[model samples]
Target: MKKRYLASALVLFSIGSLFVGVSAISPLEVFDLTEDQLHILTASRFPRLISILLAGASISVCGLIMQQLTRNKFVSPTTAGTMDSARLGVLVSLMIFTSASPLQKMSIAFIFALLGTFVFMKILDRIKFKDVIFVPLVGLMFGNIISSITTFFAYKNDLIQNMSAWMQGDFSLIVSGRYELMYISIPVMILAYIFANKFTIAGMGEDFSTSLGLNYRTVVNLGLIIVAFVASSVLLTVGMIPFLGLIIPNIVSIYQGDHLKKNLPHTALLGALFVLVCDIIGRVVIYPYELPISLTVGVIGSGIFAYLLIRRKAYEV
Candidate 1:
């Protein structure tokens, strides 16, 4: 499994290294490159590729962390109300912090994302079913409630058009200045890797972790903080990218087993590959124009979601 993921990661990096822009210049051209080609690659294509890879890996790892903490394979920001809460936070920023800087708006979104995740955890604690399947359903319902409120406010303020622009994920807008915020996910992902053992222990149920002298609650809180930060960063940078989180982790665990440390690298690599493939497709499918990544991933991810639903026994983590 490790070899498989390493190979996939190499392939993804190689493909990304080769592909240059709408111009589609070759690597040989890159070595003997003209000034114009160098500028295009350095200023535009490189940054966009970096952003896509980071967003994919970060979000997928976030999902894996959320699943481990909750002991629910289905729980993720997309399914667990985190992204919706972040979106609501963005909307609130637009309303109250009308004159706020981008950093300020992202700060507001991060706060709401943390609160929403806390609320979802509380709901997870209270739920009777406590099954992996039930958790996401509850999360979906919770997200819908939050989404409805956001839509209402958007309509009332005549900002629905603006809100819609950001509601879907589009990689085309990711140039040098706009996509740097995604770098925030890198350190947060490193934090998750650092605390991987604690997360694994916490996933073994609270009582077992307590018996082993682990501060289960603190570990859980730390995990949630990482998840919230990654989700909000991605949401604010690329708009809401659905299903990359939920799907990538499950796929990784299929061959990697449930060990968080063992799976983290694979999850990150596969997540980046999956998103890059989707983004590349979105670019070519419509030619001169482009499809939003959210739409492209949504369609493919929905199919994967249904397959996971049908093959539930195969994904018991």
Candidate 2:
């Protein structure tokens, strides 16, 4: 079964990741690890692995929820301006809240991401075309506008270097204390699983959900909140990871069907497994220097995105 293979792959790569670092440690010595090795495992390697899994799974689910709410399979946090808005929030936090805690910055980013997502939904409502591909392109343009603003401010304030750090997702700096914020996504994801049916119903349009006694706006707001929180947390914790959210859920839907409830587990597992594999490949591609997780995921996810577009066009014909 797909689940079995995914879980098995996740376990294998997870174990492999623990030993794939620049440090000279072996899985053979996992049991006999010296103090330094043990410290490396507990402090660095373990945190990086957890961060990767959490980032991958949470962002993918965020994409699924956004897709369901919008009735647009191509829509995602990446395409909806949510991540760009969050980055802008990070920029604000850096420029204004010089002494703000990381948590405080994430909170600001969450608010901005929520507003951006909500605005995108509003824009979607106004669009008459609503072509599958056109919607995400519009979102991309909207996101670019936000990103341009964020970058302009970064340049003006001479904080472009600080902003650049979050432009690409990386796990090389992950350590125990630094990665604890990612755990917040677990309970949020649990809530997502619980609301799966509601999300599915909401995708049917406002009148239908209302007839079914579901307050559509409330459900939509809840979905956006979950997405914004996940986007902001991951953006702050690991930087931008392009396409994990958009690609994973769509891949699950292709084989497993579009039911949000049924697809969450597969989406989460496949997303985690995908990111773990990408992380491994990035690590070893040019040993001693690691590629950012964004680059690898972007390259692969973009290829998949193109194939999906072509496949959708063919199906329409």
Among the numbered candidates, top lDDT falls to 2
Query: Residue-wise lDDT of candidate 2 within 173-242, one digit each (tens)?
Result: 9998999999999999999999999999999999999999999999999999999999999999999999
TM-score of each: 0.94, 0.99
**Pairs with backbone N, CA or C atoms under 3 Å apart (clashes), candidate 1:** none
RMSD to true structure for each model, in Å: 2.1, 0.8
- Span of ten consecutive residues with least summed lDDT in model 2: 1-10
Mark the regions of model 1 whose C-alpha exceeds 4 Å error after superposition.
3-20, 313-317
Q: Give the worst 10-residue stretch by lDDT in candidate 1.
A: 12-21
The sequence of per-residue lDDT tens digits that candidate 1 reaches over residues 34-146 is: 88777777777878888888998999999999989888888889898999998999999999889988788888888898999999999888988887677899999999999
Q: For residue 212, what is the lDDT in candidate 1? A: 100
